[model samples]
Target chain A: MRSLFHEELETLSDELVELSRLSARALERATRALLGADLELAEQVISEDEQIDALRRDLDNRAIDAIARQQPVATDLRQLVTTLRMSADLERCGDLARHVAKLARLRYPVCAVSGELTDVFAQMSEHAQAMCLRSGEIVSAQDASGAAELQQQDDTMDRLHREVFRILLEPEWDGGTQAAIDATLLSRYYERFADHAVSVAIRVVYLVTGVWMDEQEAASRDHLGGGGVPRAGI
Target chain B: MRSLFHEELETLSDELVELSRLSARALERATRALLGADLELAEQVISEDEQIDALRRDLDNRAIDAIARQQPVATDLRQLVTTLRMSADLERCGDLARHVAKLARLRYPVCAVSGELTDVFAQMSEHAQAMCLRSGEIVSAQDASGAAELQQQDDTMDRLHREVFRILLEPEWDGGTQAAIDATLLSRYYERFADHAVSVAIRVVYLVTGVWMDEQEAASRDHLGGGGVPRAGI
Candidate 1:
């Protein structure tokens, strides 16, 4: 009976990982639709959001059930709780993707962003997708070092985001103000995506090292102000 | 042993209620400081954040310990997990309050909002604080009806938020752009406060009813204009 319970707990973890991957794909596809101005893909992403919601609910229920039936202790309980919290975060990411896709579909014939900005955004989007993928890996492997590296990975996306702002704010871009707003907001979405990825990485770090990183401690560090966005309330 | 476990779990629930109450107070004070432009009060809110953060971490650790030691069943585990998630939400709400306080301090010298609009915002703030208080009550009592009332409570905040837009866009407010921006952002903060309060209410509804409120169902009812915010996925 104990072994069976262990098996069930393991299954719960696997399901959570699967859900993470599902969200990652949704983010990637939705972002691609945004960049390519692919109306079909945007519609597909918007239509598919319910599935993500369904998967999230399933993971939540199963995690609860695992805790009840398996009665996982210590690390296992932490893992289940973390999985549940992470699922909530991931589900919101899916909603954000849908939000992006909806924006794309709403402004279809009038693509506000130029190809130049799209290029920069594409790079940001890809790096953010990579973060999501690595975040899942770190969670599954519980790798502290890899999790630490996720922060560095996010820095690249941040750089690209700045590049986006630089291009959008140029004096020559007067006619593009509306598009600029859209691009800026899209960059925010991507940045938040990376931020959530970093959150997952921090959780992975906590899982392996048993040392939860606090933002207050990090804030105390004298920063050279290299422009890395500080995690809020780490 | 079972009785001891139940007792410890009960203590945890009590502790969570205490933490939630503290959080609601912090939010209220922060809102007041923002609306009244009280820099001293804002500073107090900022300084008091450490206590709130510490309480949050304590509640978190205790919740983890409870789950680890007691090994609760599904229903009990859901309650525990919900508490953990709600604690995070409450902490984030405190963070948002701090955010407002930060803005209040930065935008010092108190720009006066238009008379009628300012009155509306003051009332909105009161309603937000009330929602937070009611949310706490519903959580503690596990009162589904009270929780559902939060949906109604949010409408006032939302209407005030829209009215803020009208105030800002008025032709006479030409020089008030910056103040308008500040007010709009402040409104956003309160709007989100009410939002999270509704979310806590929905969670309570879920806790009691065992039936999760769907976004569509919420939209049909149209309380928060589709009430609950989407859960963020990992």
Candidate 2:
């Protein structure tokens, strides 16, 4: 019975990795759709998000069933609960990706991103996709070592997010109101995508080390200029 | 043993209601901070968010303990899991409120919402607070009846969100870029706060009726415009 529960746990972990991959792909396609003004691709990302949502529901049901049937305790219980949260983070990532796609669809052939801001967004998209892929690796390997790296990547995204704002705020800027709104929302989608990836990685770190990563710890380490230890908190 | 488990569930429900109240207060104070440019109130909201986070953690731990100790199945298990999800939604609502307060802090002494937009934001804030309060009632009573009312309030929020965008996108709009960014983020924070409240209410609906409220169903009903029945989905 114990071995069977472990097998179920393994299956659950595998499903989580799959969800991460799906999220990464969604973000990638959504970014491509935004940059290239590919309505079909944007539509695909929006529709495929339903699949991600379904998979999350499936994983959640399995986790809940395992808890009810097997009654996992201690570290095992933590793993199960963390899986539920990770799935949620990943699902939200998918939604963010879909939001990006909807923007692409909304703009259609015109392209939501202005010419000056395109490169920054391209870089942001790449960083977000990389973080999602890395998050999947961390989940599959159960290795928290890569968690810090994900935070750094998210920092890059944040920096780019600020840059986008800087461009929008330029006094002589002429990106029009529609372009400004589109750019603002687009930047946020990428930034939040990276944030969710870091969140997933943080949960993996907690699952492996049993040390809860509080917001202040993550904020201090990632946003407050680094090298700070993860503060101990429940 | 069963009676003891039920008693624990009641305690869990009470904690969730308390969380909703905390979230409502956070939004209230955060909005006041934004409109009045009240630095002290903003700081209070920011610091007090830690308490909300801690309460959520405590509630989550208790739910996990209940699951492991009682090994609840079927409806009982669903209730416990739903409670966990609702706590997360409420916690996120607090975070959105915190984000609003941080904006107030970032623009300290200078209010985020410009003169023309202040009334819209004020109304949005009030709607959000009311939704949070209603969500608390739904959780405490396990009453699904208020769920529709909560969604209607969210619709009001959604319309206001679009109105904010419309004003920003106007051709003659002269709110400086800083004000625009501040308004954009502020609007989103309030909209998301309402979204989370609706999420909590939907969970309460599911907890009572066992009829899952999928995103598409809610979207079709809310976005697709009135009288649409909730479509069945897993």
Candidate 3:
């Protein structure tokens, strides 16, 4: 019974990790669609949103069922609940991807963001993608170091997001105000996606380490003058 | 031991319902601040957001702990999992409330949504608030019929949301285009709030009736006419 229960827990983890992989690809495709102005890919992302939604629902149900029927104790139960929460975050990430695809449709044939701004967005997308990939990796392997790396990647995305907003607010940009505003909102969506990825990573860290690394990191940073801290930051 | 387990489960449910109530109030107060241009209330809502976040994180840990320690049976496991998901949906709903409060801050002293459009937004807010309230009621009472009522309220919010979009897209309204666009996104945020409320209500319906109402409703609608169906009419 004990081994069977462990096997079931492993199976649940495997399914959740699969959903994370699907979610990562969805975001990547959405970013590609936005950058390349590919309506076909955008439409595909929009349609596939239902699949992501279905997977999220399925995973939640499975996690709940596993917890109930198997009567999983302690760490096993934590794993199931974490899977449930992560599934919702992944679904929202997919929703963000669909929102990006909607923008693609709105600004089809011509990219909404152009030139230097486009480079910023592309970098932002790459950062978010990396965070998503790292998050999934950490969850799959239960690697605290990988999860920590994912959190750092989110900081880079946040910095880039601030830069994107600063450019949008500046009055010097003479052309494409509406498009820039749209891109501004798009950047926020991508930034939030990265935040959610980091959120998953934080959970992974907590799952393995049994401590809220972000909170502890923040506390440590505060104690160290907020900037002099090495390798420890929220 | 069994009674202790039941007591913990009951406390979890009660705490979640209380959190839902607190969230609903925050959303309502934030909307009121917007419609009335009450900055003080908006500030209060902003401050209260921290409490909601704290409650969310607390409930999250408790839910995970419950699953970990209790080894709940199938239905109970589903309940715990649903509670976990509902907490997330609730947190996002709180974020939307904060978004509304921020809009109130940005466009203060004067109601940004003006003239007939103001009336349209007011109606939308009314419907959205009603959904939020009904969702809380249903959650507290575990009333399936009340959950269905909340679903109908969401349908009303969706209709008002579409009407707001229509006004924004009209060619004649160009003077306050920036404000109009902001209002457009604001209405969307509220509409999405209603959507999340409906999601929560649907989960309540599932918990009470052991039937997934949304899927069944969609199936019936698809068979009936293959066109847009009113969610309220379901």
lDDT to native, each model? 0.67, 0.81, 0.68
Residues A12-90, model 1: lDDT tens digits: 6666567667777888888777777788998898888788888888888888887887777877777778888778777
Q: How would you encode candidate 1's per-residue C-alpha lDDT over B15-109 as one tens digit per residue?
A: 65665676677777776776687889988987887787888788888887878877777677777788887777676667666666766666555
Across A1-234, the per-residue lDDT of candidate 3 in tens digits comes to: 779877876776676677677777888888889888998998898788788788877777776676667777667767777787777777777777777776776677877677667888888888887777777777888887776677677668766765665565455654333554465457667877877787777788778988877753422221112111111111
Compose the digit string of candidate 2's lDDT tens values, residues A126-217.
Answer: 89888988898999998888898888787687678777877777766786666766777677678778888888899988988888665565
Worst 10 residues of 3 chain A by lDDT: A224-233
lDDT of 1 at B34: 64
Docking class for model 1 is acceptable
- The best-first sequence of candidates by lDDT reads 2, 3, 1
lDDT of 2 by residue, B96-129 (tens): 8888887777677777677679989999999999
Interface CA RMSD, all predictions: 10.2, 11.2, 12.7
Error of 3 at B197 (Å): 0.8
How should the candidates be ordered by TM-score, best one leading? 2, 1, 3
Once superposed on the true structure, which residue ranges of model 2 sit more than 4 Å away at CA? A219-234, B219-234
